[model samples]
Target chain A: SQQGEEDPQALSIQEGENATMNCSYKTSINNLQWYRQNSGRGLVHLILIRSNEREKHSGRLRVTLDTSKKSSSLLITASRAADTASYFCAKAGAGSYQLTFGKGTKLSVIP
Target chain B: GAGVSQSPSNKVTEKGKDVELRCDPISGHTALYWYRQSLGQGLEFLIYFQGNSAPDKSGLPSDRFSAERTGGSVSTLTIQRTQQEDSAVYLCASSAWLPSTDTQYFGPGTRLTVL
Candidate 1:
């Protein structure tokens, strides 16, 4: 599928625990990006991994990409209560200008 | 500098009424996009505008949905003869270039409710 469908539609974890979310796409992508939405508002750009790159990190966020499998994962280390939000993976399809988004994974970090 | 901004944070309209949602992208951004999200769903691409190029309107759901970017800065999405099913949050975003190489900045979405 052009859209990157995320797995484990919902995730519940302790505040100090690490959270991992997975996304798989069928089409080849130029790049994949992870975004976080708080209170269902605007999405904040997290990390982007290009087709040529395997991994990227930003603060407590770690993202890994596997071009061969058309899958990507986002890992948030020591997630806090504030980190409770919906995470989405968007694919910038090859040669296309717009992004195709997936039904996101709702993450709830319990205090 | 300021981030992308949307107007009328919330809207409620009758079934036959039309509503227009506005978006002002960050200054100097050359590309803008419009998306819709129903309750608990992902963003749905609606339309895209690039500098001086024809807009991509393939994702629009019906003839009643239309959008236009004026002077390549502000955009307006109009929905006519609104149905209850049309209730959703409409989001706007902008980027310096294509998302393949740039990050898209999003605005606080406009939540529309049609009765």
Candidate 2:
């Protein structure tokens, strides 16, 4: 089971501040992805970093992977109220069909 | 041009009753997945259907849970003799083909409450 464990079950930050979340997995993985869930219903994919890749950036979101430590981090720079949501880290391993997810870090961006 | 769609956004059933949740994946998407998310918990993989291949049921919690994909498009997840523990938000996602590392478009999810 390559289920990732997200750090800091919950976080609250002021607008314009940066929010960072970390995830650690148990075993080797093929890919690590981040998703944001809003209103507890739909989940939107944020980024995907393969094992071969080290870092990726999309808009204000940045993700770093350290396979040697089996950990990954997601950084949301200059967060806004609209960014308040639950963020999840999921992993896909070689020969694995499903993406195992972590419990997620709940973010609250205050205005 | 639409994303994944799920029917009966909310379902309430008595214990021991049967309920079927429907998922309509995006047009032309060949991979469909079903997952259950309990309150404050992560998404629990339920089943996966890709093309005409056999579904991977390794994540199903029990024999009472089953799913089927028809014509390689729509999917239905059926829970028989449902229990209180079955209460959760059932999410449906679909990708172009496989569930590996590709982005999966998710539906709004069907919230089920087993009384």
Candidate 3:
């Protein structure tokens, strides 16, 4: 069973725009990680934020987690066509080693 | 320096035939995992392996599905009497540390099509 759910099944935007996707999980977690997948390819780890932390940034990507709400958001600043891909949020459950993933948000950045 | 790798990027087999998928984790990685992604769906965890400990097979769907890790590095997933519902992208990933802090590195998934 999926432990998390992402909003906006699909998003389309122009180049140089900003893209924001949100995810909400069902159970307590030790950390949350975001991943990107290109067509027919493996996933690429984007970033991870521990439960103790609220926000994290990696290059142009910004992620914010609200444990109180059991939700997280991924923000891509100044997006480009190359940034178009499926974004997924994976939650590592507390005291568990497995990561439960959410239905991803497909982002399409149009040139 | 090589990343996680899976063999036979694509596979097509008849229903009821068995198939074996292989994965080689990054050197020194201690944790390995298998997941399946169907069309337009989220990834479903199939199994997990950590070091020399007993594998966590709780996620496997049925008794026909089984996996084994040899030498604590390479792993194989075998499905006996594959069904059409088993056709999906089988992905392999490995992490150097525990899930609490480790990040999983994925390999190019194997797309299996059962006819």
Candidate 4:
């Protein structure tokens, strides 16, 4: 069963614009992570936000977590065509070693 | 300095045949995980191994699926009597530890196509 659910299954935006993707999970999590996957390739870790933290940033990526709301959001500033890939949100449940991933949001940054 | 790696980037097998996928995690990493992603679907957890502890096999879908991590470094996932529904991309990942805070490095998945 899936724990996280990302909103806006697919999104298209112009390069240099900001793109925001949202994710909501059903259970309490130890941390939330976002990853990007190029076509026919592996996923690359983008950022991680712990349950105790509300927000984090890495390069052009920003992640916000709301434990009470059981949701998280990922923002990519100044999007590029390289960012045209599927983005996934995964959560590590408390005390569990495995991560449950959500149906990813496919983002297309048109050049 | 190497990242995780998997062999046979693509595989085509008959519906009744078995298949084995290999994953070599980053050196010194103590945690390993396997997940399956069906076309247009989210990743489904398959198994996890942490150090010397027994692996977590709860997420495995059926008795036809089994996995093993030998010497705590390399892992293999075996599917017996594959079915068309078993076709998907099998992804492998590893981390320094089993904690939720640790970032996992993923390997290029093995695209298994059961005919």
Among these predicted structures, which one has the highest DockQ? 1
What is candidate 1's lDDT per residue for A1-107, written digit by digit as tens?
44889988999999999999999998899999999999888999998889999999999999999999999999999999999999999999776788999999999
- What lDDT does each candidate get? 0.95, 0.93, 0.93, 0.93
TM-score of chain B of each: 0.99, 0.97, 0.98, 0.98
Which stretches of candidate 2 lie above 4 Å from their native place? none
Model 1 docking category: high
lDDT of 2 at A72: 99
Candidate 4 docking quality: incorrect, acceptable, medium or high: medium
Report backbone clashes per prediction: 0, 0, 0, 0
Ranking by TM-score: 1, 3, 4, 2
- Candidate 4 colliding pairs: none
Give the alpha carbon lDDT tens digit for every residue of B1-115 in model 2. Answer: 9999998899999999999999999999988999999999999999999899999898899999999999999999999999999999999999986545577889999999999
Quote model 2's TM-score: 0.97
Q: Candidate 2's interface RMSD, please?
A: 1.3
Q: Find the candidate with the highest lDDT and give its number.
A: 1
Q: C-alpha displacement of B35 in model 2, angstroms?
A: 0.5
What's the TM-score of every candidate structure?
0.98, 0.97, 0.98, 0.97
**A16-79: candidate 3 lDDT, tens digit per residue:** 9999999999889999999999995699999999999999999999999999999999999999
What would the per-residue lDDT of candidate 3 be over residues B49-93, giving only the tens digit for each residue? Answer: 999999999889999999999999999999999999999999999
- Distance from true position, residue A28, model 2, in Å? 1.2
Compared with the true structure, what per-residue lDDT tens digits does model 2 show for residues A1-111?
437899999999999999999999998898898999987897898998999999999999999999999999999999999999999999988756688999999999999
